[model samples]
Target chain A: MNTTTVDREDLRTLVAETLDLDVAEVTDTADFVNELDVDSLMALEVMVVLERRYAVKLDEKRLAEITSLENAHRLLTEALEKKG
Target chain B: MQTTMASGASAEALAVVAMVREVQDHRGPEIPLLLLNCLERLTGAGEADVVIRRPRGRRPTAQLDGRTIYLSVSHSAQMAAATASYRPAGIDIERVREVRNVDGVRAHITGFLPRHADATREPDAHAEVLRAWTRYEATVKALGVGRALVPSEFAGNAEPDITFRGLNLPLNLNTATLHTHRRNQHDSYLLSVAARPTSNVVIHHDSDLGYTPANHERHTS
Candidate 1:
């Protein structure tokens, strides 16, 4: 388990609330666009929120490649860890 | 202003814009001609370089210049929301007349509607169907691909919130953005705009361009 500055659990909750998805269904491998069916506009909204919460600027191209819950977790963990 | 012929890559790459105005049920061919004329004036392109696709009877028509200037005109008011991005990019507007139950609709067409869309207030059945249809059409238009690709191919994919399956589309095509704008006129209309990412988008009222009020209606219910 990667303990980073950004809490994975919190991220999951945010995703669920923002996208109106079942929190339990969000898995590490669940792709936001493919598995969760989150639209691009919503995705942008998520990015905006994440930036404000984490104080990090994610690259647009990089954000586009993140598909599953696991990918998001890994990216967030890595980013937060680097910030520390 | 007299039409002047200029020679250069900038002039050659210019996009030919077109418009069609239906006033008092007087649908004249001149609307499209004037639109093309305006495009010619805007881009300084000659008729030989422009490609016009006008469908017979009642259908959508598109004018294109290698994905640079793609213009699709539809008299249907339902199409207004989809055309808000027309100034700098291509737009496709559509209106739905029916939709199935939300649960069933998502079960079958989840790929088309993003999760956020599901969370948003469910629009009328027809409106929901129209939104998805216009988004798909706008994506195709932005890619400069005709209706050759199977709609099912775009059914299941995941990446960005907005995804375009360019499986067989030309290599030059990249990304497409979908936006919906509601117009309140004689009835409600939705417009969708699709264009290359490099292009800028500008939305203006018909009145702003000196178009007679009788031709363009207010965007309100």
Candidate 2:
């Protein structure tokens, strides 16, 4: 039931659930660290959850790059493309 | 950024001293007075205007005149600590408490820590996890890479113990010696000081300055 496609909206929904944010709050361009006040622990949570959801591997560099929904969408797309 | 006054302290008195001040004010999100005070001591620019730029999510950095001052800060419960140095540094203070997500904590430790080290061996497991968490955080802050840049592996001289203050051990990482300490009592809070090297850490209580409601000030900007 938790599996999601590589779509940006789906990715946003997954991150919103992991960070306990409403879907509307996770705008595509919003900064997770600055605007949302997401800490390192929460950042790690989002990474682990996303990796599990998409069956893709994300290194720490990629994890740090997930600063915004747009950045996350691009990173996840790249990881998914690599898996294909 | 905020403004405060610091008097009667000479930063030139010692070249290597990193004075860390702990302020017990849970009044608001940002404690400006403590930061300004620490900056004054670190910069030796006593009585001069100190402007600190605290960009959200990164360490609070100070630019006095032309040079950049490196420092790290951590806040929990009613406590906020800031330490400044001529070199890059970071600090973390955690209020010792029970952790709800034990498995999640373990996952974080195992994510980077050595697999051989037993993260959950026995008594006071929560404090060990807290120490592990803070060690990495202080390192990240010291490196000034922000939270998103945690290294894949860390081999600090930290080990698990079977006591209430078991996490109270100084970690000597490859480059920096971070002191993990417990304040006042075993149940108070766990503090890790990477503000200075092992030979230079001198912790000061804001309470020593006759800390009062009127002394500690704050602002939104």
Candidate 3:
């Protein structure tokens, strides 16, 4: 199986599409709750999107740390590596 | 007369009177934070900050100044509310709107219903479904399980010990007795409050507490 590397753009696109914001607006430094105006449901949706996109299951508690694009990319990469 | 009533009411009784304020001016996503701020001021929890514990795939619990205070927040369309009390409580408010197709939503909730569940079919099934959804949400909320609890878990003996009441929040000051009436659709939205060990749930409107509604709109996220 080919290893698909999760990149920053992939995480940014997912966040932008989940929140219906412009892709340009989802800066790597932006906070999910403070910048993207995400409540708990939206946050969960972001996780769900990531899970489906990567076909990898993630513990919800860990998603708490994926509050920014930078964080999301790092976490998703780690999860993918473990899956591989 | 004032002193008599004040003396008669216990601290817990006073806490039973939860505040349900509408901070519609704030954007939808920002309402929860505003509600916490409002709750802190109302409880006189000075210098106490709001904290939330987010469990993945579940609703988070709101804490005030490190103390566990029962809080339920809901927002739909343009309106938002924050319900705060000393006891375990849950509040839900939904915007009443026409749904062209409720079959999918109903199917999702069907497993939660008992075998002998009524309302198998009706003219107002859509509206009834919305009401039921709110009650279920409020009940789970009061149970402190939030969405993490499944409908099947609510089956039989696993049911939560909760009672719901409906209040008509007036455009002005008003007082109400808790658990007096089963929740009914109010205005354009459905409001429900669920609490364990049902008590006289009184709604203390902002004006009743000398909290002008304008104060709610003053804060911005």
Output the number of the TM-score-best candidate.
2
Q: Which ten residues in a row have the lowest lDDT in candidate 3 chain B?
A: B212-221
Query: TM-score of model 2 relative to the true fold?
Result: 0.61
Error of 1 at B189 (Å): 1.0
Interface RMSD for each of the candidates: 13.1, 3.7, 7.0
Q: Worst lDDT window (10 residues) for model 1 chain B?
A: B212-221
Q: Is candidate 1 or 3 superior in TM-score?
A: 3
Those runs of model 1 whose alpha carbons end farther than 4 Å from true positions after fitting are A1-84, B1-27, B37-41, B44-69, B77-90, B99-109, B117-122, B157-161, B164-186, B207-221
True contacts kept of 3: 0.00
| Local accuracy of candidate 2 as per-residue lDDT tens digits, A30-74 | 998667756555666677777777778877666678888898878
Per-residue CA lDDT of model 2 for B1-221, tens digit only, reads: 11222222234432222333444444453566666667776666763565677897677777778777776777655556677666666666655555544455556564324234433222366655655566577666776766554434443324321111223322222111122234553334545544322324444564332321111101101
The lDDT for every candidate, in the order shown, is 0.43, 0.55, 0.51
TM-score of chain A of 2: 0.87
What is the per-residue lDDT of model 1 for residues B72-130, given as tens digits with 9 covering 90 to 100? Answer: 44334212222212233444433333332333333333444434422322246555544
- TM-score (0 to 1) of chain B for each candidate: 0.51, 0.61, 0.56
The residue pairs that clash in candidate 2, if any, are: none
